[model samples]
Target: MANAIWHQWVGCEYRVLKTAKENIVSQRSASPVLSSYARLQRFILTALLCWTVFTPGAVQASEELHYALTVNVNFGQDLGQPLGSLFEVRDSQGEVVLGAGFASVYNTMLQGNRHELQLYLHGDRDEALEISSLPRPSPAMGTFITAYNGELLANAMNYGSPMVWDSASTTWREDTTAPRYYQTPVASGNLVFRPSQVEYQGRTIFASERTTALFFYGAGNLFAWEEGESDLSKAKVHAVPWTPDRDRADMDHAATLELATSSAFPYCYGVLDNEVLMVSNLGWLYGFDGEQWRLIQDNSGNVFQMYTMLNVYDRLLLGNFPTGGIYAWDGNTLEFVSAPLDYAHSGMFEAQTFALYGGDLYVGMWPWGELWRYSVLDNEWNLAARLFSHPERDSDLLTPYRSLLRTEFPSREYSSHSLGQRVYSLLPLSGSLYASTSARSGRDGRDIFHFLSQQELDQYGAVHRITAPTEASAQIRWTGEPTTFVLEVHSDSLRILQDGVE
Candidate 1:
């Protein structure tokens, strides 16, 4: 703690400059009386102009980026099957080689880095898959998703209880040595904050429950941590070399690193300021500085519940519960960024997911599947659109069609619960935004599809164009012959002021 310090300076600094208004008036005026009046007026106007331009309170209006909001694709219709949770896997070229769903994963055939849908095929629906270390030509299963009772996808990789999915055998093998981990659903009153992956000393490390796997490069050798003891200060900490390809008998003994922390199960993980950060379900923020873990920030138990955490401009932004507002920690205190978080149903509709597109934060809500945009520059939030991508038929046309039918038909049923939509996932693929929805009604019912592009955002509305005044002039006709005077704009400056005086 001796090395950490929070700096605070409440005062602002400003600068004052001397202008040449008197010199300009003397040079431009022919009569002394006119020159005197002109000089006074010019001096007053110059002072006001400078104040208007340099004042700290003067804020420039923010600009909006356009996006073409449209339904590019529908997964259910395309596959002729219902969809569940969706995940993305990238190839060696960094292109999406596969789109994995809870029920099945689709193989994306490519033509020079672009996916050619004609050659696509679907894989096992019930099988859960996680990408292997080297995701090239194809991705091997490194983990599996299991619903042990009521548990949801607790790990950041979106799986529970770490297990390796052997592609050849098509079976999930558990890591018997790792400590047991459980992530309760948010609706169940507890948050599941799991560490996804972090880059440490050039190697990628992912933690599932208490088990930590360190992967190396090339014909790389993998490693794992030993089962930690109950001691918070001196938990077991050692590393043993292990190879996944070798026989289970040849697997080396696990080593451990006695990381100090109060939170027994930590799920929320992020990297900030070159440090690996972890947030526990208990609301404690821990940072790892290459050597040991240190508790950097902590909120009272059950006081500050974080729904989603994101990194924007290198700083961590957390979507908090109850308030539904976004908060950022600036190495010291938390700064709240206000938005219209209040929906028809309060905290029930929390921001479950977040994505940064075109400098704005797109927040996807739970249960409702609504989308909201937070203007980073203006510090405001607005209802961008809805996730329920269904169109209603006009009664006038439907009435005639219904009468023309000889036999009775099944009419569209309307119910409150039946009309609900929930956004299960929000992904930014290529130049568009792909969203997956779980709805009971509408075209989006149980659909895993739709991509919104910049063109769609542009179609939403035109951005207001703002331009500086290009010309400045004055009139002079004291010598009988009419003369038009042109004022030449020179330089501009700004200063932050504490008070009226600089």
Candidate 2:
């Protein structure tokens, strides 16, 4: 590994200006980190940020243009998904120059969500702001949630193993021993293992698979709790995943009292009124107070199933799947924040993901891949854009997609693996918001769905960078003196961050 200020990379030298604040690249301490020779491939690379000055026609194959930085980063052997253009570079008009990112084409279920954080690397050492690559998982898959809490942990989804960067060993290792991977459900095979659900509560990050939740604290501590108490039978389980139930039928509902202490699929670790409150997919509300479990509510039988949750201006907003709304838990019942985000579509209209761009809330829905923006100035929820426009999906008809309500409701049918769509992730980067979509389950980066045309199939697992329309004035909202935006996905949203908020 070659020397670097923030991260160790081979074949290239990286240096950063510490004045970049939140986006700054620097080591934790003043001591120099050791480096070693790595087995990384070499490539002749140059970042031509001065493209604005160049002519329109192409030059000779061997021709070299005037460039800013010659950088090549494939930190964990991520060669195919190479670092695309320089980020945060502006033209004379202060517009974002480069527009490229590593996007998955087929299997969004596992490979759909890769975030483009910072791609800045000037030629000068002191004035340069380098963008380093995150290490891939050992048995590599895709980049989903890359969290930094003094240490870097990049998580691949269900099928792929999670990889943590070992600063001690100076290598990426499969997260097998530190705390074991969450086990598959009882009597269930690997198919029941959904994608890992990652949520944050206070200074803790909770990443779950099946019944177990792995907690990573900001102070560099990690623990996995697969056990819980039962609300139905009042049974106790010490090292438990007593909430037993597959996605298809009621496996947990038919269990006896003695073995009912197990848990089901957990969604988010919600903190309300200073207590750790968490809800299961089977409508089980549990509270853990650093000691034992307490059942808060049991709204079982498909009552209130939520996939994602967010904290919107002090309100804990939970994304309800069955009800098709944005709700908040009030210690007793779920109240509506935004009702039925996408009623225009059939199938489960779930508010699956969310993001905060320009201090306004933007929510992404499922099945139809609808993205909505909450207009605080207008006090209404507006349709931002439909991220997916597959020709097969009609606004009036919804089926052909896998849903959780398939078994319960006879009319709700499960389709093939390529039919489902989830607006899986919403990321705000480079002053623009990007939404990602995923299938129910997909192959290892292969788009075997011959049914979809290339134009229609492109929507799945694609990150649509929100750009602007022609009429910029209608998109702007004047807040007395300063100007806010009604449509968050405007051309101005593509500008580089001035205040450092992605």
Candidate 3:
């Protein structure tokens, strides 16, 4: 009953079959689109009327089973729309936990211990959520925190030099105190921490967005890229020891060693097959085995310029920037899975974000806000859900909840704005999928979350049962498009095989 919370009047039944047929005939003769739609409707009627005989409880069981159909209606006036909730934080127990606009979420173990869920707020005051409680997220602590690695590592971003977080003193201080006296070079400006990182032993390796530097912090040593690049031709990776007394100018720069210079900056890094893989925004993939750097040759060039990587089901999946589709690396090579490569019309065929839930891989599509699911057995991407519903885009009817949003706030500046038209982030938590939207037109976006029901997961047919207006004389009003209705009955009455025989 996951999708039970979201439903509308999906189907209708009628007794005036004679009047309905007459209206269909008149509408079909007027428009070609209607002609096509009528033909499809006829096919559905043929199958329904043929099944005149039914068991005693067959009709009653249909009601309980929610035997509804999806009718391809191009135009329909708004009926009494069912309502749902706005953006509200809910916990594992389906309780309202917190209410705030969160932009990003990261699930990690704080220092390989305390389980924590980090939430980045939407406002500009540099705030985040620290939830030490796992599974059930409640009583979250809102603190002025920066990039963290357990009780170690230093304050990142604008909080100053890589200072360690003092759990005892509850302050951001120099790393020369007790426990571990670790020192890392001063990080450059505008440093944004990526959610993915490689943490082993005492060393924590993470990359940044704008800088061509890879941060390395471990065992009293901090190796980070200098504020400025030494060489513009190649990407620079360096390390420095943590010395509390020594000044920046007094430190020796000769200890810095370059990892790779082929690419200027390493924007993305993750574990692919247990090895640390680094990719540059300029199109190059490298693998480091704690010793030498191996260039993972991507002959197809699909792995180049990837922004996101997820190792799922023993497969290294890569999501591209703005041109390429989702690709998987099979140890030796990478292959294309699915893409809307008609760039002129489809825009950029890239996945903005991804989530894995219920044995299905859901990817948040870019430019279109399409939520597509990848089935492991089927090995295909199916349209599971959408953030926005436009008649020109999808043939499915808008959920009553979504229709309410469209009708109430149809413009940009409205208080209750649209869920934009693009999904920037997706998080599957507590058996529900939460999505954050992005506005392509530089407008404000909204956050909405929902769960999919069983019926939505297994949609076998598109049903339409149009009833003619009461008795007197009815005229059916239809459009140009053919309304094709397909019925998926669980009977061996008809079968169309490969040879075109029924």
**Could you say which candidate leads in TM-score?**
2
Sort by TM-score, top down from the best: 2, 3, 1
CA lDDT scores, all candidates in order: 0.30, 0.36, 0.32
How many clashes does each candidate structure show, in the order listed?
20, 11, 14
Cα lDDT tens digits for candidate 1, 149-189: 22111111222344433435644455533223332111112
Candidate 3, residues 1-502: lDDT per residue as tens digits?
Answer: 0210111122322121121333444555443223322323233221111100000110001111101122232212211011111122222334222111111111110111011111110111111111121110111111112223223332221223344444366454655322221121121111122233322223444333535334433222433443344565444544334332223311253244344444355544444333445555555776654344577853244434665554443345666655537766645676665553334123344565654432345676654556676644344556666554432353232212345555565772443222224444444321134444433322221122123233321110111111111000001112223232211111111110111111
- lDDT: which is higher, 1 or 3? 3
TM-score of each: 0.35, 0.46, 0.37
Q: Tell me the lDDT of candidate 2.
A: 0.36
| Candidate 3 Cα errors over 4 Å, as ranges | 1-263, 298-304, 322-324, 340-347, 389-421, 440-502
Error (Å) of candidate 3 at residue 335 is 2.6
Report the lDDT tens digits of candidate 2 across residue range 1-502.
Answer: 1011111112333222211122112321211110000000111223322100000111111121112222222223221121122212233433222221221111111211122222212111111112122333432112343223212344434444555566567576666432122221011111122223322221112334435433211101112334454653332222111111212222232211122235554555444433445556565666654344677777755556666654332235667766568777655666675664546323356677765443245677766667776644345667767655654555554534434234434554434334556676665443345455556542233334444466655555454455221001111111112111111111111121211211
Q: Which 10 consecutive positions of candidate 2 have the poorest summed lDDT?
A: 32-41
